[model samples]
Target: MDKENARNTTIFLVCMVALLVFYEIFVIGPREKQRQAQQHAVAAQQQAVAAAAPGAATYVNRAQALAGSPRVQIDTPALQGSVALKGGRLDDLFLKGYRQGLAKDSPPVELFRPEGAKQAYFAESTWVGPALTPGPLTQWTLASGTVLSPGHPIGLTWSNGAGLDFARTIAVDDHYMFTVSDQVTNHGTAPIKLAPYASVQRQGEPELSKTNIIHEGAVGSLGGQLRLIAFKPWKKQGDTTFTSTGGWLGITDKYWLAAIVPDQTAQVKAQFRVDTVNGVNVYEADDVGAIRTLAPGATTTSNTRIFAGAKKVSVLANYEKTLGVPHFDDAVDWGHFWFLTRPIFWLLETIHGYVGNFGIAILLLTVVLRGLMFPFANKSYESMSKMKKLAPEIDIIKKRNDKDPAKVQQETMALYQREKINPLMGCLPVLVQIPIFFSLYKVLYVSLEMRHAPFFGWVQDLSARDPTSFVNLFGLLPFSPASVPMIGGILDGPLHIGVYPILYAATMWLSTAMSSQSITDPTQKMVSQLMPVMLLYFFASTPAGLVVYWVASNLFTVGQQYIIMRRFKVDNPIDSLIAKLRGARTPSAAAG
Candidate 1:
């Protein structure tokens, strides 16, 4: 049954690949052509209009400067930051005020709120010194109420009783990261016991209406609007290692670093806590332990760095010294496939810097990635070559063992041992690359660097689908339809489709054909075929960058397989397989 299922799965995979190829060739290609035609038509119309109106040139000049004036009005700093994070709001800490263009259309890189809504506050005790505050951390939006009234910005400040310069300038680029430091000091004559608990809360506003997108399964089945992406800690974890508390500190892909010290010679206990609060995240680091005696003037300090940003492998690897955290580096989840995916992204980024065409970069990247993985592909092909060479013997085994399962297994095992071949040996390299494949998926999804970026040629927008549409008397259509009504052209039916998806599907099919074998089991084969089709459907609406990665990966696989077959001197896997089957057919084959 297992064998049958495996065979069926193989077949299904092959079929799916074939379907993708067909879609790319027949549907997507033509659609892309139609889109190009439409674009040309629009360009001509624009040209004619420009020519007809002498005042059009004046209008263009006015609009051009008008466009540059606002953006070039002031050198408002380039979106500066090592990373960017989007802030989501929940009930506890709602985002109020002019949310007009804030989070309505795009994700929020910075957070803004009103004084009435400043229900949450972050406070920590640090040694009285200049090291703590070199400069003020700019707030994206300050509380209007507080700004109108007398007093400083809504924040906390501690007096440096010890009289030491503890100054540090840490900038908060995006709403993604928050920093917390604690300084335990003997300010009083006697020993002091202090456990600081920090909380960032969100208060509800009755009058202000908030704009938010509802994610599926964000708040369980109940499904409420997502207000903030925060996490908290409920219980303390350890001494000097407080459970990372607050919504942004101790979650997956949320990296946190810390340094703590006890009083001169005494030991300080710090416990990190993390927990969920009604879907709003909170994390707190409590300073544990008490100073027995200050002995006049003594102080201790703790420093921490917290980063809540996109899960990019290289970025995670950059801080590996903190700890070899998994899923943080350039590692893929889909097994061996990542070996190809990671490199593909790297190459595309590299080429994009010079050529400025993500699409072409992807094409080049695919070529390079395939060259790198060619050795594995060659080994696989060599194995298959050997298998094919031994197919005759294998057929004989099948003929003799029509029903002897036990004998078949024994003979096959003996044949493999004799030939110094492991039937599953070829599978390792393929499996190893799976992680790279999965990582590629994640890389494409999280990297804002690729957002809305364009590629050359017909792909003016690599971030979105190549739109091709025609509107008939039947009103406008969402996408260009493949067919129209009786008047057909009247509805301006979609005559052509986007070629990229189809091209992607084709590339997958070619790779599968060269890499995969036909499965004998009907069910498994069916599954194999359905996999690619399902994938095609999934990829249809995904970001073009992701699609580009997959396409490149597939093409690389094909090239790698070709190299493996030609370069590797390994025996044919099929020929060996055949010999094993034939050997199993003999009743006393093992005796020899």
Candidate 2:
């Protein structure tokens, strides 16, 4: 029966792998062509819209485009970009500390692209009223400092023909916050009502990911409630609006964010709308301040802020506390496991702060986790050890009632109860470790800090799959193994493992073998043996940083198990395995 079950399991795994291979070839292979065609249509529509704007030229090189426009240079420790003088728009920004790769000369990560670009994303502000005529392209005259960098506020002034004096002051901080103060003095004979409004809009969806594990589109919070508006599902949701006394709404990319923050103490209207413009998808999030009527010689001012930059956890948390932006730190893709992911991130970051190297921090975190779980794990393993020592008696009981199944079961239960052994206790450690493992994986996948970060030796770019492939002898050979036939892609997908994954496999296998004695059921033992090989392929395509964490975790687990086993004088499989191999080779050695 055990042999039959093993055969069936192997067949199931093979069938699953075959199905995946077929799906990759027949389904995933054709989507690229359709995606490209859609992108071209979106670009053509955007060009038409740009033709009507002030700068009719389509977006070009970021440097050249920035130079073409009258601008106020933005210089901060965390941001380097420009504020367009034409419309007083906050665009053309790059994350100063993030780069395209590990190379020093690699360009900084460009966060905001201009309106005429291939995938235009930016933020704009304006006044909305019956008498207001200020549009997105309205040009304002610079009335203050030339540069709008950190700690420096710049002002712009414009007077409509209708007797309204419009003044705008833009101020940015050392981080990602931008405070905009707008004042309008009513000089007309009659009173006019107006409301301040801000918007963050992106032209077309930016290649919506196929996976739903991470949100990659418009997201916001209103009335202390969080909302995630997926790009693909926006058409179904259609123009969702929320009214709150004070909250923020904005679009969020995987690692960066741009949120419209209204005064937390005042009432505002926030909306997420999808508009089709000339066959292009325009996803936008906007907030409008409450209407206020200004009489002649009366002045009205509205203060609002925007957060536009990398979604660093600490920075977002600080902003939420100081600025009262609701759940701002939730912008980072913590997935559904935020409960576990948040604490794990805080602990990992705290360790990294002291160690100064993220790789080293992961290792220390593994040790700390093992130490914390030591009490429960100790009890579980001790129970398993007692069961292992009772194996001989259990086998005797089985043989004594070989002809009577119920008698055998009764004897085994009696023996188990006499020894106070509970088989369920053995599974407790695995259950406890599952969430920690997943949460760590979440942190490594979505956090920007892990991108392009380096470990010692050749392990650069922790957020990417390991580039080294042992099939080419890890680049020891001049030729590429991918040149081989038939199963090359498969080899490259699950078998193209790096040194870190190999280390992970080794540690996991060692830990599994150490606990082999507890898996006395032949079926369980067989599955345990197969689990390590399956894990090697499973982890092969995961980020290198995650593999590092797994390897460290397994190593700590192995050490902890070893200590407990040694203390209780339990048998270890490493020695038993060696002895069995030696015995099997004895006849051949004697013959030689």
Candidate 3:
């Protein structure tokens, strides 16, 4: 048994090392190279854009881009930016409620930048057709209202020399939605055909989370079905079109979204496409309504709404409910388990309302979930405690049938049946936890509410990885270990385990060790012993909030198991350690 256990441990260690090496080579290295290449390409593109322009700045910043455009200021309770009057484009925007970082003076979260900017992203609604229609460089003139706000609406007008006059009225809510109403009146002798079109365009790719859990690219709901194409896939496809009535399309980041919503009752043709401009990839999501012929002395109007801001669940749900934006809440990336994830988010948000802290809310949410699953957990722990009590009998059976594995298994089954204990019962709690774990993970990863949320000491951003690294001695060291030259990447990547991850691993070890004490099989016992260590490495880079949940859950499970084991008078790790400590103390007391 000793030889077999040692061999299994050696094999396991070798496999783990091999897996890590393979992952580092194939996954991390390529991703890092690709990211660096993208950054360099974007910088080169910006330099080229600046060079190509006549006497433009060497590198155009956001302020420079905003100054380049003739604009109308956008001021609202939730947003602050401007409308580029050159195309009447909703181009420059920043979320007032969110910041780029947790610093007290960090800039607000920028949602849009104008065409001349490094990462130009904007939304525009216009008329398109046979007759001269308003285009991006149409040079619109503001015809009404000054600052665009919740109550104030602005009007922009442009007239083609061919006698087609276009008028657009832009209005915004206190939140993220912008209503663009376009009217075109033909003043020519002949009738003209025109169609309403709306587009959300992005010039270059922004830094993405690159995680599979949360989607960050072109997302839409067409014909009441959700469609998602990630950035790489979106680039590869080049162009994707859908014909549907009452749907929305947009580009989404993990927490931000820029979407165009056509009239819910209107039949529209929408397309998600990517174009390379001067060697830079430009992604666009656009929709156009059916062409309508305007007779002489005829006036037609079209209304389209654009959503550009943080993906707040309440805001998206309100728009979906009140404005009939189909699947607007899908912008949050609820994943395959939306039923559970959405409810979990709602519960977390609800709890947060009362507690006034998302960290506390997460703790309370875990407690509630565990309480709901208490019956199953109770049964599982009871069965485990009972099995621990039968360890001696099982050991005896194994030793008696040492050479015959079938006889050992048969006797073990017989023993379990006699004890009225189901050996598989322990798996029930773990199985139940899988979906809940994934759901809560999704909530923490994707929900805007969890972003920049704080837990207790050292966790300022729940959505981000734990900032306290063991390599830096949990921030007590003056110098950052990750800042070292040669092995910095390694230190920052895998070896940068954090306090929460360590706590979680320790709790998991305790729970797993307690459970494994009853296992007589060498391989199974070895696997159980290594499970917590593997999980510690795996979860080292996950969000601090998720680690908090796992630690809390493990501690709760340990407490439950301890109580059940004590009640059953089963030998467990806690009691064993306590008895050993007392034995050591007894010798010292006798010596004294």
Candidate 4:
């Protein structure tokens, strides 16, 4: 019994390690590449636009609207504010510029017209109290050294004056790329060290750099999510060439959060670079004068613009000069199975577009994928069915070798050969699909198409858990609020933690129950039961879209198993094993 247990343990350990290694190589590696490609494409587009239009600085104003789909206004009575999303994607913080560093009690970026400045639409968001008093927009400063006073290009700046500098007209071509630009000049007597940085920050969330407190505990890892960072470059001496700083850009998705960064030194004159290649935005930042010992009145120039937006792979591919940044985007970490599973994501997305329903699309996608893999699953099922049919004969052999452990294994192997059955065959199909399962998870988690998408009653927000209750008793415990289970919490707390998570947990349990019934192997049976419990605790607060997929996938697998078993007449192998145990308990049977 000890020897048999050891062998089983070894097999389990080996399988897990194999799965992890495969996941890192295929799923994680591709995700890294995707993020890189995205960065490159964004950079190239900016450089290309700069090269094409010398007067692009005219379009470098701030406060320009996001490219597609006007922002949606969110109305809440408790808070005297509204939430609007630009470009159909919402990160942890909404505004990307300096205004994001303002007080936390601010609203989304909006119009701020001064008494008599340029009256240009520079991007910025301001939050005036309910009393409506005005002063220097506290916690804010203008990067431009224009005469500083009240009503001097005042309120706040968004897009870093890019909107004031540029004119935006929808392209006639059927392509989708958004671009912005800005120019920086050395007006000072002495050279000012300059660097270009970019960030996409959502309100009430963390920023995307080492300097920000929000970025603490979220460094040096991609979190298997998309990251967009601007690359800052310096100009060489006589060559006057651009030298890439080549700093590492980080990506992590914790709730409504993601960020990116670049390397820069002292300030320098700069220009905005924009490239709209086949309707794709390429954003770049140039910081000149890294090593130059500026004369008393020396001058140099650099520009910066960013293709700051969603991960639309088709659009990004058009910009070719980003040194492969656009291609290296990241999807959510779904595990190691994404190589095959991503196809399912594409399929689900495609169907969702036509049907206008993500849930229905997932159902259809699951059906199609299961159908394709049916043959392989069927083969494995058949092997197990045959083995079950020979169980009585195998029991006799086991009884004969009851005193000899080695002989028991040898006899079992010989019996399997006679029956043309391979015990491991039952697990191979599972092994092959693990990565695909995880990849699908990544797609489901990162794709913005499912945000706020609904499934059914109680599941109105597919991007978060389906709330069923409101008590948050767990919140008072020592456990981390982020790591707490289901919808239950402090009913009287200041925060209104929703009730959808409890429903999500229930649905997961139901799905797991239905799928666990069909597994014949004791070890697999245990895993089937244990894994869902582990995941339910892990994903209680995970994005609703991910939990939705998990619940749906589990239910679909259960239905598939039911259909396969009924159509093929495969018996429950556990029943006979139970019967054998029952017989062994009888005194006469035990003596025999």
Candidate 5:
């Protein structure tokens, strides 16, 4: 039996290692090569474009792009930027509340950059019609206000040489929403058709998290259904078009959004497209309203709203409730388990509101969850404790039937049935914890509130990986271990585990070890020992808040199991270690 068990363990380990090697070589290696090739192609294309056109869209800086166009100032409480009068585009804006980095002096988070800039992103509203219509290059004259702000709107106007006149009024809320109203008056002898069109365009791909947990790309709600397309797929698929009466579409980052919401009652055609201009990929989400015929001496008006800023849950929910934007809160990437993730975020936020610290709130939330699951966990631990007490009887059965493995198993089952102990009862708590763990992980990964939220003692950003790496002895050393040339990358990768992960690993080991004593199979015992170590590496780069939650949960489980073991008079590692320590101390006490 022992030989067979050892063989099975060896085979299991070998298969796992082989699978990992195959995945890395076949899956990861090819994808990485493809990504590198794409990057090189883009670089070559940029160089070609720059050579062909000296002052084209080839990496012009933001300051230069902003200076190349005349503009009207935007000075709202939540936004600061200028609208380019050249195209009358909301192409330069910053979020006043967020910074590019965690440092106090870091620049305000930029939401929009002008056309010629590298990675330029902006939103624009225009009339889609004749060649003379106010388009990207048609210079507009400011007619009304000098500054755009809440309760104050600015007007811009343009005219076709033939007699078609266009006027645009742009207004902003105290927050991130912009209201763009466009009016066209046809004074020509003949009738002309025009449609309102709005687009949010992004030039060049921004840095992405590259994980499947949260989405970062084109997103929208059209015809009552939500659509999400990532960058690669968006390029591959070319253009996706939809016709919906009332909907919203946009390009989204992990925590930021630039969406266009058309009139709730108007039928419009929406599209998400990726185009290569001057060798740079430009991603756009746009909507065009139904065409209206402008007769002689007649006018038409259109209103479109643009949402560009942070994806705060409350803020999005408020927009959904007030503006009637469908699934606006879905911008947060709540995942398929939104039912659980949303409630978890709400509870965490509420607890933080009262406690004044997210870390403390997480701790209290764990306690509350454990309390809710107390009955189920109590039964599981009780069954485990009872099973531990039956270990001697099971061992005797094994010894008595040493030659016949079938008899050993038969008698063990008989013993369990006679004792009314359900061997599977111990798995109930683990099954219940799976969804809760993922839900909490999603909350920590995507919630804006968790971003840069500080916990006590070194955990300044709950959403970021723990910074005090074990490679640098938890930052006690003067030098960074990750800075040591060739091996630095490895050290900074999985080997960059920190204090919270170590604590989590220790608690997991203790909890698993406590339960593992009842597991008699050698293969099961070996797997039990390896699982915590494997998870330690897997979770080393996860958000610190999630590690903290796991640590607290494991501690709670250990304490609860210890109490149940004591009640059943079952021997456990904690009691055995305490006994050995007392035995060792007796000699010292006598000598003293």
Candidate 6:
């Protein structure tokens, strides 16, 4: 009967695994393939547009895109791009320092693409009123400098046929901020009502690494509140409106940002909107400034700013302090544990500043954190050591109360009280570190400063998954197992635990082995032995830096337990094994 039941359970488990594999292969696979096909079709269409408008910047190349429209060049310390004269939009922007990859010849990161281009993204400013106003395709004459630069600004001028004249002055500093001063004069007989508006828009869902832990979509700080809406949520709602004073809104990628900031003192309306344009998903983060009435011969000016480039933490915090852009630093998704996450970033940043390596910084951070929690860990380990020394007594107590589980537990509690060793003390240390562990992961995953930051050999980018894998013989094999047939994704994804993760696993197993010595139950022992393997898979896909941190933390734990157990005079298996080997070698040396 037992054999038959075991066979039945095995069959059920096998069937469930097969069903999951089939569901993934059929149901999930087809939908992903369809999405990719649609993306390819869109790319092909854009390529056709590029062919029609040869050498146009919107076609493919940034230079050609710049040539497609009359524009003023944007030259600054960190950004290189152009402002289109038509519609007076800030269309093209490239981060001069950041590259698309680690290679020397890789293209610089392109933050903004021009209109009519694939994944077209740009920022525009306009006046909204009852009558016809300057819209897309409206020609605006360049009235001032040939380029937009610090100490030099560009002015654009246009007039509606009804005698309302408009002019906008655009300027940029040494960094990412672009200030726009919009002026309008009503020359007609009747007064005209107008509102200044700005929008940062993308014609399609620009490729996103949609990691749920780190936000990678619409981000805004309005009414002193920070709002993050990911792609899936934005697609469902289509549009969201917020009324706030002295705030800004924008579309954000993981490392790059393009936001429109109204005057710090002005009350404004902001909306995050999405729509299907030309069969492509278009998303926009727009803000409308105060509405003003321009009497005949009256000119009113509205001033605002744009941030378009890498979201460097220091630069953003500086902008927040100087420009008083409330909570501008909140743009970097600090997660729910902002209190802990922010300080962790600051500490890591400070240590990296001194140590000159992120990996070393992580090690030092682990040391500091363990030192901070030394009291709690000492208590836990001391209690555990007491438990280890009391294991014989515990066994006797259990055997005496073997018939009643509740009586055994009650006796165990009484024994713990008499011996002044709390079994529950072990859990307190883990609870405290849980939030810290998650915060460190969030910093590694979201903070732009860590993007592409190198550690040591084999870790050129700490924010990326570990590169070496056993299936590829840690890169000794010329090709990838991912190129294999039918089961490539499974092998390449879940089964891709690499070198650092293995180190993490080893440390975890050693630590767990040392700690699990006193837990003699067969079932509990099995669970403890399997825990490190489960953790290896759990942490396999996390950033390499996070893994390094975990390994360092595990080592610190091992070090702490060694010290505390020795202090308590408890038996340590590692020390016992080492002493036994030493004792074996002593006799051989004397005989020789």
Alpha-carbon lDDT, every model: 0.40, 0.80, 0.88, 0.40, 0.88, 0.84
Worst 10 residues of 4 by lDDT: 164-173
Write model 5 residue lDDT over 291-375, tens digit each, in one string. 8998999999999999999999999999999999999999899998999999999999999999999989999999999989899
Model 4 earns a TM-score of 0.49
Residue 581 lDDT in candidate 2: 97
Worst 10 residues of 6 by lDDT: 1-10
Clash pairs, candidate 5, are none
Q: What lDDT tens digits, residue by residue, belong to model 6 across residues 184-254?
A: 88889899889989999988777777356768778988978898899878998889999999788898888
State which candidate, 5 or 6, has the greater lDDT: 5
Candidate with the larger lDDT of 1 and 3: 3
User: For every model shown, what is its TM-score relative to the native structure?
Assistant: 0.46, 0.87, 0.93, 0.49, 0.93, 0.89
Model 3 ranges with Cα > 4 A deviation: 1-59, 589-592
Clashes of 6: 5
How many clashing pairs per prediction, in order?
99, 0, 0, 89, 0, 5
Candidate 6, residue 56: Cα displacement in angstroms equals 21
Off by over 4 Å in 4: 1-303, 308-344, 469-544, 550-552, 559-569, 573-592
Checking candidate 2 for backbone clashes, the offending pairs are none
lDDT by residue for model 4 over 463-518, one digit each (tens)? 55444424335344444443445422322221223343444456555544543443
**Cand. 6 TM to true fold:** 0.89
Clashes of 3: 0
> Candidate 4 at residue 245, lDDT?
41
